[model samples]
Target: MSDVRESEGLTLLGNQGTSYPTDYDPGVLETFQNNHLDRDYMVTFRCPEFTTLCPITGQPDFATLYINYIPHIRMVESKSLKLYLFSFRNHGDFHEDVTNVIVNDLAKLMEPKYLEVRGLFYPRGGISIYPFANWAHPDFGYAELARTRMFEQLSDLDRGDGTR
Candidate 1:
């Protein structure tokens, strides 16, 4: 679901985020479907077909991820972030590693009250794996933040896909 085919340095296309993996396998999809919706503030962006080349195999690794977080004051600039994330295209890492790397990078940038990232990797070798990770800031309003997975009722979506 890339909005711009070419990268624009620090700038990014205001294109909606898309999922990177879908063909992984059926099991992965089923895991995502059955997973709980525990989250505080939720923002879902559908990167319908996100791709990142494997550093080892030189093949693309894919996933549909849901990022949920409660912000404090600082916030991520969407376009810039889109570019930052897309920079991973030629980068290779395991699903868990990539998902965690993103969450950590974002936490450092935005330092939100709470954050969670769920990577629904496509099924590989009959295994559909979804890696989920999150972070919580102890600095401010950390306790009163909404911490629930009730996903269906989430009010907004970057589209309907899960990112940011």
Candidate 2:
């Protein structure tokens, strides 16, 4: 039911011949204009099968990646996002670094009002690592919100609570 104009700049959505990348490729992320400029709403993506390699060991690392954002004028297309994340399967990086990299890439692509990436990595060698990163547009009055939310998330650990 969507018009062609509504799907401009989107190439990976319905293409049946799309190929998956074997490396980290942020260039594959595509976006389209946001229709709701008059309101602020949350957009969230949960990728439960995210996989990458450890930078040092080259062993596989698995994670559930959470991406949350408030769009400004453009929004990432879902199929492209899936491909972009899939591109990390063979990439090597620490969980922290990988989480930050994804956030940075999406932030640059959309320039959203606010964006955050959270990676809940499965235990490797008896240790689980959770990496979180976020950004807020300086002039958009969301900087404080970013700080506060980050604090709240981190503070749960300080209180001996495992919830995040």
Query: Which candidate leads the pack in TM-score?
Result: 2
Across 1-164, the per-residue lDDT of candidate 1 in tens digits comes to: 24222322222233355444322221111100112234445444444454565567877777766666666554555555555556667677787788788788877766777777776667656775566667778765554333543342243333444432
Off by over 4 Å in 2: 1-7, 155-164
Q: Roughly what TM-score does model 1 have, to 2 decimal places?
A: 0.60
- What does candidate 2's lDDT look like per residue over 1-164, in tens digits? 24653548577777889999999999999998899999999998989999999999999999888898999999999999999999999999989899999989999999999998878788888998878899998878899989987867677556532345
Report lDDT (CA) for all predictions: 0.56, 0.88
Q: Whole-model lDDT, candidate 1? A: 0.56
Best by lDDT: 2
